[model samples]
Target: MKKSLIALAVIAVSGTAFAQSSVTIYGKADIGVARSIGSDVNELKQAAGSRVGFRGTEDLGGGLKANFTYEHRFLPDTGAVANTSSFFTGRSIVGLEGGFGRIDMGRDYSAAFWTALAGDVFGYDGVAANGGVAGAGYQTVRFDNVISYKSPTMGGLTLEASSALKEAGAKNGSAIRVSYASGPIAASIATEKGLAGQKYNGFGASYNLGVASVRALISKGESATGVESDGMLLGLVVPMGALQLKASYATLEVAGKDTVQQMGLGARYALSKRTDVYTSYANNSKSTAAKKNGIEFGVQHNF
Candidate 1:
């Protein structure tokens, strides 16, 4: 009887410890077939960047918590690594969180990336995405060896900042962003200085009504030699039950270079909570070249 009692006591203690910690395994996969106006061949493609990841959190006393995430991208069609050289190619983060806010150190995203994503309907990885304009002119993406901080929201306003340390004679990069979201309105502004003497600034905003949401962003950048360029993107989203409609337009104008424009439309139908079917079409036009159009049909599932 005593041995059984001791076994039950051990099980109870172990269960309580696990109740204070949680871990989750999550991933998304998307694949599609696409055709372009100029090409007669159909190609297999990853509609959006496919990724798998693990995340966990542990609660500590005094309102503090420890968190971690490890993620990587892959090509679903071929089952090949998308990041190639890096293992945790999507995001590898370790951080601490509390009332004062959260601080993380790892290979992570830039402040300008968050700003651009604030108004992008299709995000950066999609075929019909509008982030190309901003991404082309700025390093509004991931950074290696970064330390970042995000403050707690106050009156719907939040602040974020990040820094990448210098290495091998390279210049240090830094970025900052301020954002506000309340009710039907959202807005953000960000600026960054990347290595190789590149500088960028961006602003974005969006408004939501009962049936639709509209968003827009503009970015300006300068190269190492002082050549300047500007980019703009506009997007709209409409939701009807389990179906959604998305559209966007983007433009980029560079000094001493031809202007580029793109327009895209897409639709998504949710089959369940974790699976969806989507299709998109995009037209690309260049001032000095012929126009091209592409279409994509794909399915996505999350687990």
Candidate 2:
């Protein structure tokens, strides 16, 4: 009886300890140079992987806990971490989480954008799904003032919603995402629509089957920028030992005429848990447009 009592006490104490004091710093830094061939001109580009997360939690009581997270991105090649105008991108945010799931207010990602990105291969890389010329996605990586809600996983299913406040009469975007993971497979679907002033709507999904993962995405937008756009994306990634293989095809149609199609292939070698070397070759073309065709290759590392 005494041993049993002691064991119970130990378990209780251990559980409490597990609930408190956990501070960890994690980030991913990837560097790669690229070549773009279009208009009889070639350009070289380098970039950094997006990651930098710190989180912790403290038990409150009665199955309740408090938690927080902070994240950011940086360029490893040139050691530059700023906005496009050489000012400050100010790329960092902090938020909290708990039983009702989590509510983050500050400079946070849009539900739609995160959903599209979460379901893509190459972590958005040069894959069409990434949309950002390489991995920027169709819409920009939203930040500013925002509120996001993430519901608890309900039987392998998760839901996320977000809104960025641009105030009354101001153009804003709203997004939602649903995801599920089971066994050796994971999947996510999402949609985003613009409100206030601009207009954007999109759908995306992805699946992983142990050795290979596949992704797809589509988006449309109309805005005061005299804009009309549509896009379709497909991607694949296969793993072989410490090496990974990636391939993808993407197509974009604007208004009812201009079009862009892209195809890319790449390889990644794991150097360690936090480091890898990568190289990719990609080409882009316009079916009925004049955007020209382009190709690229490079390597990357994370730390």
Best by lDDT: 1
- For model 2, residues 1-303, the per-residue Cα lDDT tens digits are 999999999999998888675777766655455555343444444434555677676766666666666665556555565345422233334455666788777666677676556535656664222454222224646656677889999889999887878866566667777877776556666666555344555656667677787877666665546566676778888999889998877666666654566777778788787677777666676633353444444555444
* Candidate 1 error regions (>4 Å): 1-9, 36-40, 256-258, 287-291
Tell me how many clashing residue pairs each candidate has.
0, 5
Candidate 1 lDDT over residue span 156-196, tens digit each? 99999999888776677889999999999999999988867
TM-score of each model, in listed order: 0.93, 0.77
Which residues of candidate 2, in runs, are more than 4 Å off?
1-19, 37-45, 50-53, 84-92, 126-129, 132-140, 167-170, 184-186, 224-226, 287-299
